[model samples]
Target chain A: MPSRASEQVINLIEAGLRDGSLKAGSRIPGERTLCMECGVGRSSVREGLRVLEAFGIIRSSAGTGPDAGSFIASEPQEGFSRAMAMHLLVRSFNVADTIEFRELVEGWSAAQAAHCEDSAQRDAALAEAAALLDRMDDPKINQETFHDLDMQFHTLISALGGNAVVDTTLGALRSSVLGYVLAAVKQLPDWRAEVEILQKEHRLLLAAVHNRDSAEAQRIAVQHIRGFAERAKIGLQQ
Target chain B: MPSRASEQVINLIEAGLRDGSLKAGSRIPGERTLCMECGVGRSSVREGLRVLEAFGIIRSSAGTGPDAGSFIASEPQEGFSRAMAMHLLVRSFNVADTIEFRELVEGWSAAQAAHCEDSAQRDAALAEAAALLDRMDDPKINQETFHDLDMQFHTLISALGGNAVVDTTLGALRSSVLGYVLAAVKQLPDWRAEVEILQKEHRLLLAAVHNRDSAEAQRIAVQHIRGFAERAKIGLQQ
Candidate 1:
């Protein structure tokens, strides 16, 4: 019941990451090895690995060989997204606030993409957004898949925004809001009208970017967000 | 060695919060009581309380008898900030990215404040920002305290942006950048010159907000951020 062993293990692993003692993709010692090295019970070592895995900081595979132990994970974005989602859920944050935050970050991202200090990344993002809009016309696309594509389109713009921190924060926030968004959509009797409105707004927003009109882009983005939130019927509590 | 007790405790408390078993400002049972209730050892109970306290989910005051036990803490912001700071440190994030992220959020916030339909909040924010700028002229104000005031000014704008997610994220990011910003400023041989430049930009940005010109406010705010990043000799990490 004394869990001090677990905390020490976590501290050790974190220290390893910070000091560059454990690089991405490096394998951690086996459970037995950790038990011996850290002088904790094997059960405690396993528990520490479980915590790391839950945090998306490590990956585990079972086998009898030497390579069957835990390994450091390189998917930083996954860890970030999960951490953010858990925090949002635990806090019972307002969904409207999340949407508004997205509007701000994504608006700047769109503006930056339009300016295209580098033409290639800008063109790629614009093309991706356009492609997503084209796919939105398909009646066969399930709501779930369509939502995933929608996320990609937005993520592309954020990636092109030329700000890693903004991109990461917005990406995580968007993912966290997915449940609220889907629940809102499921409640609607007719999503066609809602989808159409958003599509038109997206087209205009993309055009605004193509024209390097930052003001128009920002305005359209905010309006688009507000419209979606309204459609979702999420109140202040969400 | 069985740290599952800690995880069990976390799950129980989170469930309590979700299911309304625990309300804000309510007192939790003492260690002995929790141990009996949770079917775990006292040490395990204490460890769980430590983790919860670390996350600001609960608070414990040291005393004996009636007032010494744990009480559920209602404030989520402290936990959010602590998680954010730890996340950044673990990621070994670059300072430039954090500044750029702050700029994007704050720029959007300034623009939102300018275009806010709620004029009262806008006016209040403007007054706060103006007060900070006015104080910049006082030679008696030390840089450290002034930096904190400057944070409050920007924080006021984020709050006025009408988004809790944005406000919290920007606030946490701003706090994370404080160490690096102060270090950079201290490195400058002629620090007053940099302060003057930032002050002029701040006044101009506030003027834009005062005029309710969202576009100008956004532009000035973004430029102010970029300019400061440059003065600090930090690269955007292309």
Candidate 2:
């Protein structure tokens, strides 16, 4: 429900973006300047800037120096994650749909990783994933640490697919439900046992990708994800 | 880059959302009340509210009437689409990656539609898709009209998968690159011929789904998408 004046400001900025006049790191005009350019009041300009900042399309600072004021930004992940979490909170989309979507993307990513053409790059990625797994193996670490590493492992596997859209969307999805996931883990009857099983599945998934078995990698990816959701009774409410 | 006070406001609202106190359509406190609650100034409260509105977590109206205050909202699609488009503008993710991601999701959705257990719902969706195709086949339609129907057709197929996340994300992705897609269509050397080819593919795709040929449905979905991108030389820069 942005005002018409604010919408004009947004439209002007979007036009600049599409025509290449604006770019990441480019400085945006101040409120006064934008008000004149967009033919809107200062309040409208500020409102439009706030919307842009919330979307991570721009970053702003307050000072009288050269570095102050708004600049174009490319950090959409934070905004996307926050917005998605809010959407989930409002029940616009349910957990089961999210789990299903994640399964498809993550499974496809794993399969693609298994079939990667560059052996050197693929091996390096696998090695990085292995390192993450080793960290998860440390029994003294807290559940939060384990969960953080777990997300990194899955994100790394998706990154190996070399699709930025998949990588970003998957990362956002993981972060959106992070609190629910952590709470579910804490509620588990035997956290240690469940961790062990998750670790084992991770190892098998890595091995499938390492051995270039695309089908097996995909199958394991789907099973590992759905199994955890089922075990935690996370998305069953839908 | 929200100020500390604004961050507090966002955190408080998020907590309310998590605890079920801030359901959709619930009216948010006014700016002065929020400022006092979050121990911030009026500006900070407005900033926080703007961020929430940009995320589509809330909507506000002018005046002091009962319905004039901010209310929790669930319209995340507009914000998500705008952010994604801006991300694409800044080259955070390229067109090729978006196209690839779409192929994966849409192809899987088509296959799901083909294998759908509920024949009545499946047939209804397929008939809807067919109706869209019929509109696209109209010889007098403009490119914009044709493009709109084309997107609707793809979106409907994805909806048949019954995954809300997929539906929303696919719809956002389509909207995010809409201008670029339309421009590409206009640039085609033989627009009518290309349209004819796309129509044939659409008809065949619908037929495959109707026949419950999951494999063929998926195959056609991918080919139709990739084929158009290739023909238009779109997303070839990567």
Candidate 3:
């Protein structure tokens, strides 16, 4: 067969999961059992498990009996950010494109969240944004902290939007694009001023959401992102 | 060490590529050399190579001489898509959500493409969309062909948008979401009516782009996607 034994193992396990023959969190067979069942060598079984574990598809533990075996994992989005972010960094995508991408999704998300009927969720999202803003004045605050809070702010907005796909995709993209953005921000000459403006813009975004003005919220959100992109051009030039 | 040896090897190779030590199409050292250099066994090297090969990050050909070793591959985006698509499928993301996600990005891409300064690129995009329309009526068209054309249309628009990050992110999302979308579409009644409407919408969208009407193009594109999402819902319900 053209397929490697390890790949065959991966396929069998995936098919089992899809067909409900293997349920999430259930332990898989031991190395010997898998070797016999899949008709692959022990090394192939182990390699397959290693690949699955790498993708967060399975968890492995050591001991004895059921606890010792590999189990299907429910880490749906664990490795998403790392993989995407690393790839994006290598590609060296420009700040304008990144910001534009972010704005398009964030604006849609804000529009959705603004019209969301759940007052508690809206209030919670606003509170999260407020918490991040409150940390803006920390004397020892570094670029990484700022970057993280920025992601949290965007993620909270996406979740409030109530579209799970948009929330997840935006969340992953935000995480992946953080490193490049941080690098760009740190190179800016007037970063403090820029951050202050961003903070104000964020407050405006939250206020627009509270007022249920989706248009205003969307408009401000896009502009804020565009402004960041424009500023990053200077850094790019340096 | 807490880390698996195979994963360490994967990282080592990735670092080399990112740092320019391993340029694209360069031949990687044989298994023995990697084993000695990385202080891992031959099996570990093999496992790492398997993972990379699966990723499309490298290619191996059968031979007995210097050409037998793994060589760095071009088009890393292909690997990105394969890995991402598999994961997204496993997560069972809703097709409706994926359609909505595509609408947001694709609409933006259309508008951006409308603004492309390069006449050649703009014409190429318009031509591709038109060509897909021409092929819409072939009786032998399967779901895969339909999905491929659908992706080609969106990818062309994204490329015309002139944003690598947006293009790549949208590309991955489009490919990753295709499996579920095809499954959902297969369940639809009056699939022909739906396809016809989609084709008409595609034409109108193309007209807007041809006329350089960014706003109208975006509107038509979003509506087109929303229509499919509704059809997909009906399909899922059945």
Candidate that would win on lDDT: 2
Expressed as tens digits, the lDDT of each residue in A52-93 for candidate 3 is: 665556778888755787877766555444445445534444
DockQ of predictions, in order shown? 0.19, 0.65, 0.35
- Residue pairs clashing, model 1: A95-A238
The better candidate by TM-score, 1 or 2, is 2
For model 2 the TM-score comes to 0.94
Candidate 2 chain A, poorest ten consecutive residues by summed lDDT: A74-83
List ranges where model 1 is wrong by over 4 Å: A1-74, A90-92, A115-145, A199-220, A236-238, B1-73, B86-93, B111-146, B160-162, B199-220, B236-238
- Can you give the TM-score per candidate against the true fold? 0.69, 0.94, 0.83
Give candidate 2's error at residue A67 in angstroms.
3.0
Which one wins by DockQ: 2 or 3? 2
Give per-residue lDDT, candidate 1, residue A124. Answer: 73
Residue B11's lDDT in candidate 2:
88
True contacts kept of 2: 0.63
Q: Write the per-residue lDDT of candidate 2 for residues A128-169, one digit (tens) a residue.
A: 999999999998989899999999999888888888888888
Instruction: Say which docking band candidate 3 falls in.
Output: acceptable
Top candidate when judged by DockQ against the true structure: 2
DockQ of 2: 0.65
